[model samples]
Target: MRILIVGGGVLGTLHAWQAVERGHDVVQLESEPEARGASVRNFGLVWVGGRATGAELDTALRARVLWERIGERVPGLGFRANGSLTVVRTEAELAVAAEVAAGAEAADRGYKLLDVAETKKLNPALRGDFRSALWCERDAAVEPRVAQPALRAELARSGRYTWKPGREVRHLSATGVVDDRGERHDGDVVVFCTGAWTGGLVRELAGEPPVRKVRLQMAQTEPLGEELTTSVADGDSFRYYPAYRGPALETLEAGQPQSKVAQEHRMQLLLVQRLDGSLTIGDTHEYDQPFAFDVTEDPYEHLAEVAGALLGRPLPRIRRRWAGVYAQTTDTGRIVHRERVADNALLVTGPGGRGMTCSPAIAEDTAEELNL
Candidate 1:
């Protein structure tokens, strides 16, 4: 089968990788010269501990294994098992941490609640006054700058897939795609992994409902000079990810909003000290339609303040600041849709913000769905 996959985000790359691995001739096209959307702009977390404790939880668990398997199957992918530390600063935050631990237990996820001393022991960077931490041993992190391109290189090296790096696909058909250059390459199937750009492509393909893009703002700090055992965040970050939100969303929705920590917002601080000394800290979600991306300095200041409060260490240097965008679902979950007329015309998107950690397994399933 000759498959033409549109949009070379994480999911697009996954589709191409799996289809090629399964003996299909796959061709992946992207609008940007490189990945310009949320895939490259995230904290690169392969979350295993924070997903809702049912099918979503189960899938995330399997997804963790998938992240590991990729490293094994294709070496140098840079997938790391650094784990993650979710901290608690207040009684309410501690309750939320306990809530997550309970969900992990019910879902048979291997996680342990860390007391104050234990939390400090796990991450020496943790500071301020914190009550507890939920440690999920299997959860991991990766460097997207290394991993995504590595996967793309692996697929290209296999020679089973024809990768067109700068090809901007303007139109898609059950057969193949018509490139921006007025070139058409017929194929057996078409899959759109456009991420935030899915809305436009959906209308072009005349598909159901639609996919939307949400902007995420993040910042990276200079070398922290310490090895972080895992990615870390608090209850504020948990509520944003549906997997972490769990079955208590209704309760959470009704919960009163706390006083503004700063800037009229109170998101928990998230941190992942990469293999490099630099700590990858982030992120605040500011949902917008077609054009809602502005990487301002205010979010960075707020992030540093929160991180300082959590890590108990003043960041001396902020080497970089940036933004990311990902596909969002009305239901706030990943959407994997198929057009009724063409079984091969599949739309793999709606990851919201968890695409990095979740796409590996999803890509495997996508290949299966395409029967490649």
Candidate 2:
């Protein structure tokens, strides 16, 4: 089978990975010389802890396994089983953590309520005043910036994978696609993993998928000169993830509402250290279309204050700040929006923030469904 993937982001790359691994020839096209979507602008967390129970959690766990295997094969991925710690400052937040930790599937989700001492032992960099932390040993991280290129390099070695960058897909057909160069590339199957690009041809074919765009802001800091042994999140993250929903969460929310700035930006503080020792921190969720053209400083300032407090010091100088958008389904229950747009083509997207965490498994399922 000759697979044609229209998009070079992580989702498309993972599809290409699956197709090529299944002995199928794959050709992936990207509009830019490199992908610069939500795929790269993320914490690269193979997050399993906070995934809602059932299919979502299963997918994340499967992806975690696949990520480890892929990371071993692609050293450039920088995959690490560093896990995560969601620090809680108040008893209300602690109650939510305790409930999750005591859930029936807690072990499966790697949920453990950690005391201050235990939390410090896992991530010594956290010297802040926190009552305890929710430890998730199944969580992990990767280098999102280089993951695609690294995967494509490995795919190239397969001798069955071809990557055509700087080629915008202008026309989609049942047989194949026509690029901006007016050249047609034929394939047995076509998959559009177009990320947040929902306009133009995408809307024409899918007629407005049950998905929408989500915008977020992220920043990278200069080298911290210290190892942040585990990824860290503030208790506010409970509001963003689905798994933390329950009576306890409701109580926490009622008792301890988000800060005004946090509420305004729909913010959550997630911090991960890059291979270079720099911290990648982000992010605030903005769902309305026509997102703000400019990134604001208030969110960044709040993130710095929260993260700095956790680290017990001021954050390193921020070197870069940017905003990115990703596709998400209106129905949060769905993992992604996969549909056959044409006889030979399928559109698989809307993994939302889970794109990085579940792409591998999503692609694996795509292969299974397509009988690749």
Residues 1-372 of candidate 1 have per-residue lDDT tens digits of 888888777878877877877888887888788887788788878877766555566667778887787888766677788777777666666666677677536336667778989888877778677778878787788777777678887887877777676877776666677887988978888887877664565665655445566666677788887766678886576566655564454465467463354324335467877667788777765554554445667667777877777777786488888877676666534334334335557777777656786786777877776556
**Candidate closest to the true structure, highest TM-score:** 2
- Give residue 159's error in model 2 in angstroms: 0.3
Q: What lDDT does each candidate get?
A: 0.71, 0.94
Best by lDDT: 2
Off by over 4 Å in 1: 103-107, 199-201, 243-256, 259-266, 288-293, 332-344
Model 2 alpha-carbon drift over 4 Å, by segment: none
Q: Where does the lowest 10-residue lDDT sum fall in candidate 1?
A: 332-341
- 1-372, model 2: which lDDT tens digit per residue? 999999999999999999999999999999989999999999999999989889999999999999999999999999999999999999999999999999998999988999999999989999989999999999999999999999999999999999999998889877799999999999999999999887778888999899989999999999999999999999999999988999999998888989999999999999999999999999999998779899999999999999999999999999999999999987767899999998999999999999999999999999999999
